[model samples]
Target chain A: MATKTLIEAIREAMDEELENDPRVFITGEDVGPRGGVFRATMGLIEKHGPERVVDSPLAELSIIAIGIGAAMADLRPICEIQFADFIHPAMNQIMNEAAKMYYRSNGTWTVPMTIRAPYGGGISGGLYHSQSLEALFAHCPGLKIVIPSTPYDAKGLLKSAIRDPNPVLFFEAKKGYRAIKGEVPDGDYTVPIGPVNVRRAGDDVTIYAYGMMAHYAVEAANMVAEQDGIAAEVVDVRTILPVDREGILESFKKTGKALIIYEDNLTMGYGAEVAAILSDEGFEYMDGPIRRLAGPDVPSVPYSHPVQEAFMPSPKKIADAIREIAEY
Target chain B: MADQSVDLQANAASEQARPSDSLSPEILLEMYWYMLLSRRLDERAWILHRQGRIPFHISGMGHEACQVAAAFAINRGVDYVHPYYRDLAMCLAVGMSAEEFMLGLFGKAEDPSSGGRQMPSHFSHRKLNILSMSSPVATQVPQAAGLAFGIKYRIAQQLQDPEDETQPRLALTSLGEGSTSQGEWHEGMNWAGVHKLPFICLVENNIYAISVPMHQQMAVPNVADRAAGYGVEGIVVDGNDILASYDAMVRARDRAYSGEGPTLVEAKTYRPVPHSSDDDDRSYRSRDEVEEWKRKDPIARFQQYLLDRGILDQNKIDEYEARAKQMVNQSQSYADEAPYPEIAPSLDPSSVYAPVDK
Candidate 1:
């Protein structure tokens, strides 16, 4: 196993898929010879040529529409929106077209495409560049939403998402592109797209999260365990939609205390669903009230470093929340 | 034709209907047959709506000539069609059975389009390469560009890729003149023009987009005038003339398969009927205007043209009417008997995105 960064893991998964299946191709604003603004698709155009790695116009609506049509025509398309915040223009294509194609067509037609967009705030990428859009898509039933925390999970889960029969919205935490590193097995292996990854095992309180927030939750769990001996469980909810209900309940059952975290705003954020699920199904097992720690509903992460830092949940915030849940 | 043709578009209106060298009598009759079938279906739907059997009905009564002609001129199975709701004639020409249309109208389990999911006239036939439709206007326009792009891509990657190999493919996407105002429509057309994908767009301008007239939709007198902006050639055709519409689409298809890029064919016509069963056109337009357009009906003009060419007599015309009526009657019976989909009373996991729940 070799240690790779999160973005490197994503590129590796795409490289393998494009090599394995010629039907697979990538298209976005700068995903071609330019190698994408984030460089997540770097070296891919050199390996796969221009046709397999297409450069689309700046129109986000058409980008997703092309994916839908190509997918319908028996091609596996990985359409990247340059940034997470830029997906709004393509929302109709995503929500009405890609998301509902299968169900609307009554399973006769399926959109086997993946939409990749780098999301979240930590890199001083103010309003437009740093926003989380998972909650908005989580409400859509036909779409599979996957956001991985670690390099290993990013590689495996992305591969799984690409191969999934339905359309999957793969949101990469831009903050962890190079910062997060983990040992990823060489060659062929896929982490399935329906379960939670238990990063740390504990017996006191459970912390559930996804994307970059999940990475911070594990760190907070370790911090609480070392200093306060809070014994907190940390579960990375890699797949957001059709969430790992059984896995979530199992993790909550161990600790009997739940604290959900996310980088998106708190109002109806994805974590609220987890808290609701815990309250609904894990009620009898709960030893304390479920807690949610998320960004304040301020539209977006501001440009100022302190404000952006304040917007996102850090290790200290998660540790404090975990400690409070354990005490409760 | 227009007195002075625009720079970006070629005018396709013929002053009189001539016996076309391009179409044989058999092909013309086939086109007429489909047109009549679609009209009969549309009329029957209105009747059903009036009878309280169905909730909604949208008629393509006056748009049939261009619809059938454009469909007949194209390579049906090889080309893809992203049709708007008022494309009944086009769907029939592409091999969708009449009963299937009825099944869709009734939203029965046997409906091939959406299996009781979508409303009537939302045409879709998988085997014929007709893509499924959504209610949103102009959304399929971009999808059409994508289909053309996919075809171009697969052919370019023929050796390495395993997509079907008929090198040339044309994606024919059509919408009412109203849909051109949508942002997605521009996005779709721009993509087609930029890539020079094998694509053709048909904008059936029926004068009025429901209650709103053509003048309110855009500032330009013609939708074809917008073609230069997208770097594609546009054509204005007399949609009521079957021969002219056929010629426009045929020429557009030739340009696409030859790698000349996309062509926008704006077919000028009129919608005699109300927008749908839900609306009243009388509130907006006068009865005199409706009656005036009915005189220029495509079916009647085409029938008269065929008679002038000695293609058929009154006896043959009666027979065609009998055939269309019989098909529609049988389809209505079949759809009425078709079963409702077997969805559970509550939320069915299988219908939604639980395919990966395991």
Candidate 2:
């Protein structure tokens, strides 16, 4: 195992997949010699030749739509949409073709393609560059949604997505790319698409988070454990679409209280879906109503530090939600 | 280079396969049959939809000849196809089972294309290598290029010997006229052209897009002319003429397979029906324009051409129509009997996202 940043882990996964499978390839703007804007595909083109590491035209729909076509021809293509903010141009392809290929064709043509986008805001990426659009893809039925918090999970989950016979929207949190680091294995490893993992086991209040919010949840859980004398069980849902309802329900049962934390807007955010699912499915096991700590319902992610802090779900807010739920 | 010339010769031979000589006598009859069948299926689906039997219906009425001819000439199973929603004839000609089409129309559990997940008109089949059609138009164009590139890659894998047979080529994808307005279409065509990728861009131009006509949608005279900007051959084919469509597609496929890059075929046709059962074309289009296109009816022209060539007698043409009518009836019956997907099935997301065993 080697200690690596989230970006490095993603690069390692791409390198490994390129080496392991001739059919596997990476295509997007600056993916070739430039090695990607975030360098997630660094040194891949040199190692695997230009054919495997294609530099696609600067068009989002072409980048994504072509990836779907490539998958239909049986090439496992992983596409990078420079930034999640720019994905609006290619939203039709992702929401329609890539997502629905399998179910649309009744399993005839499965597009084993992965679309990796740098998502979420924390470092003030402005309005266009930072947005947690997981809910957009999560709303689509056939598409598998994945958002990893750590480097290890990023690498493994990316590998699984590359090989999986279904279309996957692999959202890599930009803030977590270097902010989070862990020892990732050198050899081939795959993290299963679905299931919530226990981040820090506790019994008091269950905090469900994913992507960058997972880190904030951990900090909140730790702070609550020390200051509030409340144990917050944090569950990082790696795969957002096929959410591990059982694991989340089990956590909710153990804690008897639940809090969903996300960086996306509170209104119609993925948190709403989770909150609804828990309330509807595990209402009997709940002590109080499931509380949600989400980014305020706003059009743009704020640039001002104070305004941004208010827009995003902070550890303090999450901890307060945990405390409120625990006391209730 | 020699292989290209030889393929061109074979194309010439296929064009002159029988004594009648014209494409109408050779392949136009079959093309017409598929078009009528597809149209009939669309009609039946619209009726079922009105009766509250099916939820939705998108008709591919007037663009049949171009779609069917392209589908007929392509090597099924070997060649890949990325078809847009308006390619029902293409799907049928490529061997999409009537049962699958109807199941898809009815949004049934047994629908091989969408398993009741997608609405009607979104067709896909595995055996034919046809990528599933999506509701979002123009998105499939780029995907078709990628699929064609993959076919080349796969063919490369099979060519163990340096002096072995030339790489097997795959036909690219088809799209609508309005889709040309999307940037992906230009991007995809340009990329495929620059790379000399084996792909054909068949633009199924059925005049209007909902209420918007070609004049309002594009500045250029024809979408095909835009291909020259990307260094690919562009041809303006009479989409309504089955023989012309067949000739155009056959050439496009040959040019693509022979490493001559891509071809942009603008099939100029008309949409007889509305965009969907929900649309009212009379509100947007003129009666005079509709009448003009009706005079150029693809099925009638091809059928008449065949009769004039003595390749198809009146009895044979009637027989084919009767057979197509019977097939449509059978498909509608099958669709009626088909069951809707159980709402409870969605509770288990495993069916949708099951892991592929490595």
Candidate 3:
């Protein structure tokens, strides 16, 4: 096992996939020589050469549409959107083409491609550079959604996504690129896309989360264990599309309470979907109604430290929701 | 009418026929029949749209010859095709069954193209190497170029292997005269032409893009002429003439296969109906222009040429029309009997919809 940063793990995944599959390739703006905006594709152009690691023109639509065509032609293309916020311009390609191509043709055509976007806030990158748009894609079918909280999950889930026979939207939190570090296997390995992992075991209440929010959930779980006498079991849904329903249900059965958290707008966020699923599948297993702790629904992330702190779901918010669920 | 026009043009070619050319009379007849089936299917779709049986339809009426001829000249399954929404004729000419085309229009579970997911007229068949058609115009151009590049890459792999029979040439994509206005069209063409990729850009210039006429779309006068900027040769053909479409497509295919580079064939034609079922062409186009085009109908000219040459008897014409009508009727019945997609099954696979673990 090698201790690697999120960026290094991402680069390793690309390198390994490029070496393993001839059909696998990487393409995006500044992805070839510039090594991507986040430098996640650093050394790939030198290692794999330019043909496999292509730097496309500034046409986002073309970049995505070409990737789809390439995937349809049996090439596994890993595309990057310079920033998560820029994905709105290519929504038609993702929603209409990538997400619908498989079921639209009744499995006749499957787009085995991965779209990597650097998401989440905390770098003071402001509006366009740091938004989490996974929920927008999570709403669409015929697409697999993978979000990694650790370097191990990042590398393994990415490999799984690259080989998966469906379009996978791989969301990498920009905040965790260098900040997060974990031991990743040096040899080839893959983490299945549809299962949730219990980051910390407990029986008081369930703190369900993913991406940057997963870290906050774990932090809150530790704080609650130390101070509040409540043991919060945090479940990280690594993959959002084929969400680990078994993991969620098992956690709920143990704790009999749930507090879903995310970094997007509070209304209609990823947590809402989880809440609905638990309600439909495990209503009797719950001690209290599922409560979601999500970011405020404001457009601005605010420049001031206090307002910025108030924008996203904090550890306090997760703990408060956990307390509400546990007490109920 | 496009079929009739091509037959007339082919008859005009009999005196110049060379014995060395492998394109025989039987092959020409087959090409003509494909065009006829496409035309009949297109006409039925228009009528169905008019009668409210289907929501909308786009007719490939005047562009039948170019589409059908190009389809026959290319390799099926081995080659890739990124067709525009209006290339139903090309899809049928390539190898799509009439039943499949009808099922797509009906948007039924039995529709092999989309299984009722896509809108009517969006054809997709993996077996035929036809990419799923998107409603966004000109989006397929770059995709076609990339797909052709991939085919060439695969062909290089095959050539390295001892037992592979893949030739590596992929029949690329085609779009409308107005679609050339899109940046993707130019980007795709430029890439294909610069690399001398095995790609072909067939421009179905039907003179109008909904309310906007050809003059409004581009100031360059012809879409084929834009090929010079892309570093490729261009050919202009009468899209209404089946024989001329065949000649242009055959040459384009040969040029691509021989590694001479991509060819831009601008087939000049006109739309015989509104853009879609909801469109009112009369609001924008004059009746005089429509009548003039009606006189130059391809089917009428081709049928007359066939009758004059004694290749198709009067009884054969009746039989062909009857067969076409029966096929369309059968397709409609099949779609009607087919079931709708289950709502529960449409949930996200990674989340709510996965089957419970055993």
Candidate 4:
């Protein structure tokens, strides 16, 4: 095992896949000599050359479209979007073409491609640079959404996403790129697409989160455990679409309380979906109402530090919400 | 009206000097047959839609010559096709049977494309290498580029040999004139040109995008002009002239195979009918204009050519028409009696993620 950052893990995943399979290639903006905007693909071009590590033009539609075609042509293409917020231009291709290729063709065709985007807000990236679009893409059937919180999950889930037969939207938390480091396995390993990882086992309340928010949830759980003696179980939902429903319910059943924390807007966020699932199955086991601590319904993410802080769900806010749920 | 006839005669004269002169009389006759079959099938589909038997119908009446010619130019089952909605002739020419078209029209379980999941005109046949189409226009353009990139990459890496007859594959994608205005179209064409990928972007300029006319869609006189900006060759042909289209497509395919990158071929034609069952061209276009275009109907012009060449007489034309009609009728009846697909439950939860080995 080696200690690595989330971005390092991602690069390693792509490097390993490119080495393992002849069909595997990386394509996106600045993914070649520049090594991506976030330096996630640094030194890949030097190792794999331009054909394998393609530096594409600034067009998200073609980026995903080429990935679809390459995937259909029996090439495993890993397409990177500079930021998740910039992915809207390619939404039609992703939703209509990539997501529906398998079912629409009656299994005659499959788009085995992975679209990686750095998502969420913590870097004061303003509106256009920071956005969490997991809920929107997760609503699209035939697509698997994998959000990794740590370097370990980032590496493992990305490998699995590259190998999956269907299209996968692998959202890497930009906030946790270098901020969150963990010991990842040295060699080949894959965390399955859909499974909830119980980070800290507790019995008082279940704290559900993914991506960068998972770390905050653990921090909040720690705070609650020290201050209020409320043992909170931190459940890192690795996959958002085909959610770890059984594991979530099991945690909720054990804790008798649930609090969903996310960076997306509160209205119809992934938290709402988790809350609905718990409401349907774990309603009888609930001690109080299922709560959600998420971003407000603002038009765009704020640019200012103070305003952005207010916009985001910080650990203090999550801890306070967890304490309130623990008391309830 | 006099000027239009002069242009048609000039187009016919130019065809004599084109590469189509090398085509055998038998091949020319076969081209005419597919074009005629597409027109008849389109007419039947419109009638069925009017009778409320089908939900929708997109006619390929005026576009048959170009679609068939392009299909004939490419290697079937080898080159990937990203066909648009009005590609009945293209699909038929690529070996999609009348039964499959009828099954798709009726949304029957036996439909080869989507098993009734997709609407009619969203053509897909796995054996023919036709990519499934979506309602969103111009989305397939980029996909075609990507497919071409895959083919080029495989050949260059020696993963697949170019010397192999079927090794060097090209991608052919069709779209309406109005679709050229879409950003995806430009992006896709640009990517193909940048990568020097083997791709052909065929724009069937039928003069109308539903109610909107082509003049209102773009300022450019021809859709192929946009190809210049992408650093690719652009060519225009009389879409109503079968031999002209055939020559253009043959040249385009050859250029692509020789690693000359993509070619944007604009086939200038007119939609003889309303865009689809839901559209009414009479509201936007004049009846007089439609009549004038009908006078230059591709099928009639091809029939005239066949008679002039002594390849087909009136008797042969009648026989071919009769066969096409019989095939359409039999397929319609078969599809009408076909059952809807039975919805089945998923036996494995991870089927979508992991391919279950058969």
Listed for each candidate, the true contacts retained, as a fraction, are: 0.57, 0.78, 0.41, 0.71
Ranking by lDDT: 4, 1, 2, 3
Q: Fnat for model 1? A: 0.57
Report chain B TM per candidate.
0.92, 0.88, 0.88, 0.93
- Any runs in candidate 4 off by more than 4 Å, and if so which? B1-17, B344-358
Candidate 3 residue lDDT tens string, A190-293: 88888999999999899888888899999999888888889999899999886667777888887778898988778888888788878888888878878888
Per lDDT, the best of the predicted structures is 4
Each prediction's DockQ? 0.66, 0.55, 0.32, 0.67
**Tens digits of per-residue lDDT for model 1, B39-148:** 99999999999999888888899999989988887887557888999998889898888999899888898888888888888877777888888999999999999888
List pairs with backbone clashes in candidate 1.
Answer: none
lDDT of 4 by residue, B100-175 (tens): 9999999988898888889998999877899988998999999999999999888866778876766538999999
What TM-score against the true fold does each predicted structure earn?
A: 0.96, 0.87, 0.88, 0.96
Kindly provide the TM-score of model 3 when superposed on the true structure, using C-alpha atoms. Answer: 0.88
Candidate 4: docking tier: medium
Tell how far residue B180 is off in model 2, in angstroms.
2.4
Model 1 per-residue lDDT tens digits across residues A1-328: 8999999999999999999988899999999888999898999999999989999989899999999988887888999999999999999999999888877777777888999999999899899999999999999988999999999989999998888878899999998899999999888889998899898899999899998988899889999989998888889899998778999999888789999999899999887889888999989898998888998999999999999888889999999988888888
Tell me how many clashing residue pairs each candidate has. 0, 5, 17, 0
Q: Write the per-residue lDDT of candidate 2 for residues B1-358, one digit (tens) a residue.
A: 0000112342342456522244444465666678878877877878888988777888887788888878866675557777777778888888887777898887788876778877776766666666677676666777778877776665564422313333226655887788788787887887788767878989878767778877777787778768888888887777787766677787787777676778887777888777887888888877887787778777788778767878789799789879878988888788779888877864455555535886
Model 3: how far is B147 from its true place, Å? Answer: 1.5
TM-score of predicted chain A against the true chain A, for each candidate: 0.99, 0.97, 0.96, 0.99
- Please write out the lDDT profile of model 4 over residues A82-162, one tens digit for every residue: 999999999999999999888888778899999999999979899988899998898887899999998998999999899
Name the candidate that leads on TM-score.
Answer: 4
Q: How far in Å is the alpha carbon of A309 misplaced in model 3? A: 4.0
